[model samples]
Target: MACRDDDYRFLPIVDAISAINQNVNLVGVVLETSIPRQFKGTDCFCTVKIIDESYSSPGLLVNCFGENMEKLPSVHSAGDIILFSRVMIKSHCGDVNAVFNKKISSFAIFEGKHGTQFLPYQASANFHPRDEDNKFLDCLRKWLLNRNPDESISLFGLNEYLPLEDIRVGEHLTLICKVLHICKVQENKWMAFVWDGTDAPRANMRAKKENEIENLPPLQLEPTPLPRDVLLKFPTIGTILRVVMEDDNQGLQLLNCDRWVKLVNVKCEKYAGLWRCMLMPSSKLQYLSDTEKLISESQRNYEKRLTLKRRREPFSVHLPPPSSMMTETSYTEMPFVTLMDVITHPKVTGKFKCAVRVIAIRPFQSEDFCSPQGIYRITLTLEDATARIHAFLFAEDSEYFFDGYPSDRTLKRTRNALLGVMIPSGRSNEEQQCAQRNPPWVQLCLKSYYTDKNDKWGTRKYRIFATKVVD
Candidate 1:
């Protein structure tokens, strides 16, 4: 069945980036630059890197640009997630001058009049994206609006619900707003939405003098910024939300702010034009406050180190060897990637020590064995990159990895993840015998699905088999 408002949970931008191809938004830290969102609102974008061809070579090169180039952010920091929306998309025919593909990116400069938001977020004990629920989703079918999406609502004084009355732009606002009308964006214009939520005095019924406006000097106000509370319309950035809690008996509460859960997965959707809910929380599991505190601390420490490193070093004349590339330092410097990228890409070798998800699994076969030892390959893209390319992690690495780990989950602490070890699927009986006869007949294998006492998955990582579909 298609999902309704109540059937989905918010996905974080970080999580969404890994599965970006599904028409979902790619979320990551916003790259700050003076270019201004308006300037590059339209253009091509691409990311590139060098790799060791086989065991050795001058260096294998791969660059994504062209049609794919339309997705790049010229000013985004290396570690930031650049969400592309409402842009012309196409693959590039490789720039002759550029190394690899000259995948230039192009997109709207201003990310639209919409602005920043900081709604309720359930930071993990370590502040990473959390997935208390493991169900898959098809698309956002409903929404949990703090106010009616279709109504022109008034902003009652601010934060009326909280005991504090001091109004701030970034603070979470819970006010009693009344509906007047619904509006939308017209050709490059922000649609005017009048509000009558407050009293006639506060309700937006005032008439603007048209002639008086024409006399005013030309102004380039950035945008009519909405408070973070206005973020309810966004499925990702907010906290635990209930888009369609229970459409049947607990029908839609267009005006009921309490009906909506706050925190959410900022990763699921792109930061672009308006979109309805695709997923909503299945449960209201209380996040341990301590977890949030710890996550904040971890982020702080990580950022502190990053800040120091940026000030300490510069460029590299030669690329680091691929095998020895993945490292603790690389994790922060580069955007998140799959194990394949970590191992294959000459630049991203070590960072993937942890942080990957299992999206699918090809069941381990008996024939895949080197002298009775199992081997397997896990396909994955970086959990935080717009790219969704798969990679391999070897059986040796899987088995030799830290103790008591779920082979199906993202490798521990490594930002790069692809479930299980990367090993060739020795599908042919002849290939199996050739290797087995030689001695170590490397056969591929992986522990795909494992569950805990309540039939819930135990690993932070999950596999989404090709045959499977998000609900």
Candidate 2:
């Protein structure tokens, strides 16, 4: 570890966000991040706020865009550090902001901790750090250790509770919901299914196809999956959001299935045509008691839903009940079951008849439907008034469902046909609400079984069989 002239390449000196007067390099601790959304074609865009010891009270806003998400900064927590090279500062809508320059700007992110060295956890393709950068990082880390946690909370501004039903995509807000199931997806990723006894707005499927499934780490749910009984307890009506939690997230320590808790600094976004929530590094989780006012509010909502159900006319609703749409299938005599009944049945391995509407299709890419080995694979998220569950159609089953291998051209038409509801932008709120609460139903044969016979608790699955789409 000796000194060399070649190693001392000239790098732009770091400038404070407050003091920067021109296009320059800067570094600061990440305080907040908006959901990364797809821009034109394959590009990604997001808004982030950062602060340093020099300007900690009023953080600087940055509009970040990248050719792809991999090029964008991944700030896992509030105290993480980001380094921007050759960023241009601009004023927009009466506020000063930093904009990423595609041609010249590069970025790097480092874990912000007291003793962590000058190594970056993520960086662009062609980024190199200067010798002076190490000392700058050291200075910021020490300042962060002495920073007040309360000050950070005020900047986060997550005091109000947003019911799940009222949440709009792309907004970072707090929520008070009940967790039904929690399980590890991978070593560093966890998934918690939560609901507030109210349904989310209609799922929007008009987003860009290429951005449907952003490249991220795989969600490996096979190992240590949620127990079957616990999964069955998931609410039948209303929305159940999949909340992703990172390994280092503080909420991971406090959250458990079946508890009512408050989620602060959570961002809502659409994933695979359905709404999903993310717990950011700056996010916090606190458990609530039964007597809390928020709990009472949620209870009243649930009661209101039951009242609507009792008052609504059976066949007059926009979406009819499953029984009303039941078809004359060959498995009709086998005894039809609700989506909830299918999962809670004692048999664990049998064919059951049910009526459900297709809510979502995955993997979003048509190329993913056909494997390189020429095998077909598709999963449909089906919903009934009783509950929602994923039913698979693979190999021959997929071919039969589509009459043959489905091409990219016919995918949308087929998906819409199966979905039964194509919500347009101009639909009235009353009509949209009616459609979301009651979607048309279709009859099918669903087979339930455990993936591993030896392990019955965590390996249960459901698949579609003897079901074909007739033109």
Candidate 3:
């Protein structure tokens, strides 16, 4: 992988890491990178920390900005080589930094393999690499090969790792988990649901007070970037911890859906009776490779969860026997039918028992479960192998399902167990497809009828009744 003397001749003469007060071209190994985040109106930016032979202890920081992500450095892994062209040299907070010039700054990223061919997998549209750049890339690869891999690419700070399920309130700790989904809550705020395949400890809740229910505002909606189908694939039975990242532009740019990441210095606290994790000012985020030990542990837990679920009552048990239900109003013994049969039955009004799994629940937050009338009104998206439908769980049925009146904190765990938690099954492609399937089946009594019996063709609705979920 050694480069010839002629290859060195084409490169511009510049100091390895000491160049200051002047624009200079440089090459360095990427040590860290921020997730790209949108700023201003349409412009996006990210920061990359790099190191070279001359600057070994600490890395030099480079600030990259572009009209869009396409023009920024897309550094996917540590130890990659970045070739900067015409970057402005500047000082920030008493530290030298490279400021990207939109008009003249350009970058090219090369994979850090020792003997791979000299080629840039990612580069700006205007970047045109000459033979000299290839030589520099080769030299960097050789240097990377000779250095100790552990010391070269190991992430710094907050080495202690804690499981999502083990986090205690008021504790600031680091955690490694897979990011199932990231959705904007509001301006400068995002909610990232992360899971490590283990169930989170239930939060402590206080008894409800009469004042708690009075003068509450109407329920409002929170915007999420994920679509229905994507959300439906989230894990049904594990602890999907909610993480709030506030005003963290660099951290936001660093995260992506389905990626495994290490969250450092996250503050865990209880909010509205549910455990919540937030990123503090000192918190740092590092992307983890698929081979990370914590990630593997999470995958094992995920698989075990699915195995336990399979051992539950089979869907066939819910299939109706030869003797059908005698009468619609007969509470003695009603035969169970598939969800499809319940929905498409010829009767304009009918009561039936079906086997289904709860997929998505509306209101998103448990706090909104109470209606203005002080009754619990929740909508559940239930699905069986054959069909998917929405069924209303309100009034007496809602209270019965929850075993009592629903309160924000007291029954948060119960509500989650009934509605199921949302997290993708795994980070790998194959396991991801498996997450799309519905969870184990449970028997539910559903009443299907038209809003107006006179107009049979009008809106049809389904209501869940006489059903209770047991832990």
Candidate 4:
């Protein structure tokens, strides 16, 4: 087990610190390893820090650059002991580091009871002095076996904020970002654009399809119809959110696991006189001070944008203006039926006007029978003091009211657009239009009918379809 005097000696970390630019060998336990990042062309590099308890100095940072990075994962891990040979001692800006020489250096990893195994490297055979290398490896293995696993040198528990550039595919990370835009793509899929206060490109964070509800973070602020209600109502440009994220092939995404993300609520007392003061309504921003007024203004702007965007396209048939067809009339002129009247008399089949509050609007796919080509429908949940009922809007009517249709040309885009309108903003264009023309409540002029057969609810229900949004 004795080594010859000519054999290369492994230096202590303290000795390696003083031997800048000199080739040295050292055995240390891997403490931390960074994710591999691409440099020029296809070349990748990773940084690793290792600690040696036998030395009096601190852990040494190892820069594993070039093609040798391919073997890094297999060579060592957080708890493994590695023997680095012919590594150049490097120093810059008063910080010392060990640079692995990919062309002439080699490394051996001693993990668990696997003894010693040298990884293939350039000129690896000529660099190893067999007897001396084996003796050093054996001694290091004994020292590792005698030590407790918990007592091993590690650099965990140091929570540091990682920049967007440092994020890599398949790495779990936590980030604080601002919500830029939100769109609902499907019944369960919600996509959001976020910026992490960096110059990096905006990232897309999507709600995971599976375990969707269970994984959502608890709202730190008061409960509202939508998450980040205030931000969604007003400008979504600067709403801060703290989220736990993971990178996939698509890019950085919200972590699908439960309780991994949260919306950090700003406590006014703790953040007094800070930048968050502008975000709070009780403070100085004049326009944002009134919640009702801000929501009303935001709703108007949203409708205007949606209307202008949809109106630019050519339609198969010319549409009439809202004022021309659905003129406001007194209650006696229309004989408006209350929602309770229709619910109580399920067989009611006649034109009746009802003033009701819009609760929810969703894209409807009818299962009763086949719908015509290029025809789309929407079901609006309307509530009055008496009862709640679903009113269907079909084809051209749906398009006129909500700017949505099921035609092949605009099916997908229209569906996504309608969903986005319903989700965060809390009001559809039809609802807003109705509210504007009629204060306190909106009236729907429609015909109601009931099928002879009973449904799952065990009763033949009355169905209403709006022909116009009457005042």
Candidate 5:
């Protein structure tokens, strides 16, 4: 049968193992095959042992039953690469297995030179080349080449690392370790304490400054101390890392000019998928797993707790007093401009801080706006005491004002507000009252810009992009 477009794309066997109960696609070389067998009063089934280069040791067992079994080519044998789609992943004991769905799953055997041609058993099935698939195959080929005994210091050889305790001073070594803690030691400099699985002291490594880091190759996928937001997303503590370092006077440090540090955990297919979802708008996060949803909820609650704790704590008397220069810095730097100033001075385009009342909020029509897919936009009629103007918030920015709540109800309310209609349900009395207030107030940090609307007036319109929610 034809696989649905929603069927999972091909993943490494390791990822298929992690994503149990979900549909998966896999491409593997068949190591062994079994003849079709029938159980009493049940459908005939066949089994095949296949291996993808991503995993070593025991290969994956694919069980094809019913129509899938009937559709298997008569000459299918070992050494053949097959692409399986829409197969359900199930855990049997401690091992993962792929079970074919009778109606929606299909397989294609790659049959030509360079493995370009895929012959599908069923006409309804669609098979096409994917960039990720090609990249995976290329990686697999490199791995296979490295596995040959004659190849010395192969590309995949870095997986083998010497024990941290075994290294002597002045000796260059590769080691797999986990980051235990990271702290900022100086401006643009950070220290990381790492521990490999050995009876050795934790290695302290310092990050190179921008000037030194600039000398490294651009294509190197090495792990470094990331920005605060990016660092929070990574499984830093307890996640494995591969690094090539030298035993120096100050214990182990990264080799001065090479791209040797690699964060291994994020390379897992499941984590890679989660990272992609994070980059998307809040609307797109719905497809994430229940585990991810729980993690996000927990993180939000923790942040709320921290905020409340900070609010309750009084300022310490021992803290140093602010300098006169520091006190005046805020007034001198980036002063908030009035809405009238923004409208009159079209050339003055930059970030502005302002407090305004939301007179009306108009949600843009999804079909009319040529926005990036999966993103939604809202227009706010914001007015200060002097003048009123429109500010636009898209996707992530809109979600922030809505208190990180992304739902059809929120969209409906914005749409209704644009038409001056009331939905009048689902919300509590307090919320309804708040919505009916004379004017809703909001504080904003906006990016000001001017655009020619090409209207009957034949003049440019001033608009602001809502970059942040201050209140």
Candidate 6:
């Protein structure tokens, strides 16, 4: 479940097959990786096993195809060493077959592809004696003996002052290097080059003749805003809106977004789960101005995001929501009650069942949805001697309670939480009798309706309808 920091080592691509195929999780270095017919129009993505000092078992390999592979820069050729972290697990192959599961962690290239330890000092534990596997151990001895606190040295400490003659194409540079450019990427493998080189490589280049793809750098372009005269946007359920978060210093702005939740005010980081999703014309975003603490903390987060640590700015007002804003909220956040409370007082967990006292209620109207279903409309909240939640009765239960029960004609049992109204974002969890209806790790939103009362298996009355939480 975790990669050992001390086990940080590189492995050869050849040795990881059995482990990868067998499902042993690991993290290793890239010994040799290349995509055949590099530059095929549509790049290939694949996984393979690698060989290295970490283990002999087959490890995992990841191949990024097309432009996606361009993100991986090749640092060395065959025999060029690499470093990585891998995990092993079980995975299903395609739709019909099952395969072993093992995965790799981070991957990067090095200048000295062979014969050298990346961090000589830490590596000296096993790399001393100038052995074949520990060819790069000498540097650790030199670095330790040449320590100087007052002198300014490059990021590599004393490594930068060393002449290029001390480093070679195949000689691996252990310092963490970034991918400057991707020379080639293919279906099975990706090629990368380091950024530390004094010279710049080709930004875009064609792969081999067998490759159908070409490399191109990503472009950044800002589009003009839509003119106010050009309105008439049909509201959508998931339309995204942009809100630029401001830096406290006022030097730069950072942007984030959420579904068009109607904004009533200008606020940031209010509730535990609530986020400030820009304001708009039809919303009441004015209430957001009440949050003073959140706005101040947000600025500090914004400043770090804009890379403005050195830059300063004057005090400024966070921008208000535009007149043309669309707000959207998810049904998932709405809370629902448990059926257990109906059979038991404090709780109705599988072991103990209890009955509950009904409260207020509201039935959803058909007019609320564009193309609505009656199932999701019923939301309720109820409380027993112990706790509370939401609940709803389906067509069968509603018809039976209203018409079948002839004995109850003398009294009316109108209710609130029992009718299935719920508070948004509460400790609501739903358990299902079958796997098909299993919920997620956390609370789930209401979805399906009861199609058949016969399938209830006597658990209906004991179940939850919906609920509302009080602040």
Best model per lDDT? 2
lDDT of 2 by residue, 226-333 (tens): 566675676545667878853333224235567776676788886644677877755655445444455777888777755663321111234454345523244645
Worst 10 residues of 2 by lDDT: 309-318
Candidates' C-alpha lDDT: 0.23, 0.64, 0.62, 0.42, 0.42, 0.26
Query: RMSD to native for every prediction?
Result: 30.2, 15.0, 12.5, 20.2, 26.4, 25.4
In model 5, pairs of residues that clash are none
Choose 1 or 4, whichever is better by lDDT: 4
* Candidate closer to the true structure by TM-score (higher is better), 1 or 2: 2
Candidate 6 per-residue lDDT, tens place, 296-342, comes to 34335435533442111111122112111111113333322222222
By lDDT rank, best first, the candidates go 2, 3, 4, 5, 6, 1
Q: Give residue 25's error in model 5 in angstroms.
A: 1.2
Number of the candidate with higher lDDT, 1 or 5: 5
lDDT of 4: 0.42
Could you say which candidate leads in TM-score? Answer: 3
| Candidate 3 structure quality by residue, lDDT tens digits, 160-235 | 6787657787756878787887776666666777777654554333222221234221111234324544445565
lDDT of 5 at 193: 41
Per-candidate TM equals 0.19, 0.44, 0.57, 0.36, 0.28, 0.19
Native-to-model Cα distance after best TM-score fit, residue 88 in candidate 6, in Å: 5.6
Which residue runs of candidate 5 sit more than 4 Å off their true CA positions?
1-8, 40-42, 73-75, 111-471
**Tens-digit lDDT string for candidate 4 (1-471):** 111235577877777778888788887765555444444575555555666656523578887665634444333224456677778888999999988866766666555224456432223333464556566656656765676534432222213333332333332333333344444433433334433322221122221222112232222211222333323332211223322111211111222211111121211111100111011111100001112222344345435533452221111122233234332323335545555454444344656666554443453222211255655545655644333466676666554543443344344333333222223357765553333111123556655655644442233333344443332
Please provide the root mean square deviation of candidate 5 (C-alpha atoms, Å). 26.4
